[model samples]
Target: MAGVYDFTAKSLAGEDMALKRFEGQVLLIANTASACGFTPQYRGLEALHQALGPRGFSVLGFPCNQFGGQEPGDAKQIEEFCASNYAITFPMFAKIDVNGNNAHPLFNYLTNQKYGLLGRSIKWNFTKFLVDRSGKVVARHAPTAKPEALFREIEALL
Candidate 1:
């Protein structure tokens, strides 16, 4: 099976990013939106990144517009919004689809590794997948799951 490190995605800056850079680190891979009701969760996710980052953990944000057009922005806009509003310091990716035939390869592998409550397809923006240090998808979190609530699971992996 393809692991998280087997894929690459474009960063918000438009540079191709190889996931191998994150190998051996616990990861919270989240599909995000800038204007959604759960947008505030960015703060908590940033906090998690700051608190656990020194211990081989990081948060990867992938902005998506698939859900209600909430993340309608170009790469620069998305980057600016995240920095100005949430002060996000973690890596943010270019806009991508989380569902359908056009879905990014990384997201396809993620949903395949761990099915959500609704099945393999992502249900909404902010849907999160926890990848362990070995690059396996360990858990799938719903959009409603708070970032702070994931501390114990992340700590266990670390």
Candidate 2:
């Protein structure tokens, strides 16, 4: 019966962050990459964070290099890239695998709560999991599903 609140992950700053901190907030948890074709989605994701943050919603980005080695940068580099390019103000986590045996536990829990077209395994960068205020996984979005396209669903949850 564990929910998203039960997991912890390292922040991009290298500090352990308990997911419980976001317990009552609606969340869009995405496996992100700096060099992927969808990297531009960061802007939309940031917009969502800024626009809905005051309403108890947030976006959590987790950098992953498993897809085409697109996000090979170290923590500092990743932080710099996001700030310079997207002005990303949302919380971002340190680089971690999003598939196979080494996938982060948070991601494992996310994928388990909602299966994608490829089953529980993540198929690419930008795969997103939406969690409601109660920490229940509500939907799973594909890499092709732009962040902006999720606004309606997110708003409803809020």
Give the TM-scores of the predictions, in the order they appear.
0.99, 0.98
Per-candidate local distance difference test = 0.96, 0.95
Clashing pairs in 2: none
Tens digits of per-residue lDDT for model 1 on 1-158? 67899899999999999999999999999999999999999999999999999999999999999999999999999999999998999999999999999999999999989998889989899999999999989999999999999999999999
Give the top-scoring candidate (lDDT).
1
Find the number of clashing residue pairs for candidate 1.
0
How much does each candidate deviate from the true structure in C-alpha RMSD? 0.5, 0.6
- Alpha-carbon runs more than 4 Å astray in model 1: none
